[model samples]
Target: MPPEHNAGAEHMLVSMLRPLVERGHDVQVWLSRYGKAHRAYEYRGIQVVPLQARLDFGTAARRADVLLSHLECVPSTAALARGYGKPLVVVCHNTHRPSLRDVAAGQTALAVYNSLWMEREAELFFAEYPKAIRPAESLIVRPPVFAGEYATRPGKAVTLINCNREKGGRVLEQLARRMPDAQFLAVKGAYGEQILPALPNVEIVEHVDGAEMRERVYARTRVLLMPSSYESWGRAGVEALASGIPVVAHPTPGLTESLADGGIFVDRNDIDGYEAVLRRLLGSAAEYRLVSKRAKARSAELDPAAELAAWCDAIEQL
Candidate 1:
């Protein structure tokens, strides 16, 4: 229900809901807090309504048949679903600390995890809670990506999507300094903006909408850098792979599963290792081409239509 920013979770929500609407499902998205000013709008035939208060939600729930809740809205949405005796489906976008309130709320809903690693973490987290507070059912649904949206092209620079400490902004700075000959492009993320003043070789790019990623970021990216401390699924890495650009990232559980053999995995703190792999890719055209081929092949496995169909099947059964 947050404004549809360039974040991966928001992108996934739009991609999934749009197709459902196209299939003749009368789907409406209700924002709990944000985007209240932009009260009503039609996006890809899906109606978005902003709920201002508890009363507004109660009124809306009376008209709705099922409740689909995101992470932040789980507590309130779960309470409403219970009150209305509706089936609640909670979509877990990331690995979050489970509070007693969240655990209690989860009991009344079916959980849909974005990745297998996330599902394992959620199960572990819920295991610490009382049995009565555990979710009724849980399922893993990898986030969908439109491979057609990206293109393979000649690239000249190494790109990092998000410039924040948690996202490996400092790692990018170090790499930029070590490889002065390599061009580094840092795309501004939703959080943190203090990266520009430190690194001279790294070019800072303003954040663009997800639809503009190919022309604005991937087209000029020889390799994608994802040095995040944690990742639920690594959406940017998947996007880069779709463009035939190899991702060099720390092997977080989500990134490891998403990239498979397509990525160049480096330890989170291994600056030397990252530099070695990147230098090899930049210096040898053959190596880059080989990795690009692997990247494309791996990306082909992600079929958006298939994923959407699976979602439809699951929702129908629910």
Candidate 2:
């Protein structure tokens, strides 16, 4: 029950947790609990209890019946939860697990993947730990974007998210330089500071929550720029499309599937293809309108609340 550190994780947690609380299940969120940033509070009427860091096992065991954690950070939480005989649920997001070298060192942990690709990775990971517990198949849940408040795109700035610099910053910066006419907004903070300030045309804003993020990023956004190296279903792309904004990206793993034909993909380093696609979309009001319309229509099919309610039903059965 760690209060997740990232906005995407937070959104998913809120969506899933809210329903469970309404159904009368007690919920507690543990994190870097002693830190000032980690405050105990209520969210949507659910009481949030933040446990202090380095807390004793006896204290943690008294609190909950289950331990739900992210896949990558599973080892410590799983071990602790297992010691207390609590049911552990690992929400897997990545398609790859730690290398064989890490496994041989006795790191046996549970994982529940977001997609089949990640589930396959978990199988490979558990090959090294015969006793490793895997999260129930019923626990596998899709990452969700907040819906209902989608806005019509104003066909202005090319919205680029500088999530990970090693992943997409250089290309976005270069594109901003080339397409000087196109205004670029970097969903900025932490990692973004490295490149966002250097580009004069790029405006940087602190991270946004689900609903606000959808409205703000989609409101004035012309095209969504996602040049990611990898993703477990790029949430931003889903949000943009849900808001009737088109995305242009490189065909990275999860993103390729998530964006589908709702996006235009450039061949790796195919700057010309990228430029041409952008120009084509920007050139015609009619073409832009059609793409935006199709993007939202595609996103509507993956309804967050419906999917979340289904997930909650499965979890309650556990």
TM-score winner:
1
Question: How high is the lDDT of residue 150 in model 1?
Answer: 77
lDDT of 1 by residue, 198-314 (tens): 566778898777777889899989999998898889988988888889899998999999999899899969999999999999999999999999999989886667767877776
TM-scores of all predicted structures: 0.90, 0.83
Residues 77-141, model 2: lDDT tens digits: 66766577776665656665452222222323333445555555656766866765444443456
Which candidate achieves the best lDDT against the true structure? 1
The deviation in Å at residue 181 for candidate 1 is 2.3
Query: Model 2, residue 44: displacement in angstroms?
Result: 4.2
lDDT of each: 0.79, 0.65
- Could you tell me how far off, in angstroms, the CA of residue 97 lies in candidate 1 after the best superposition? 3.0
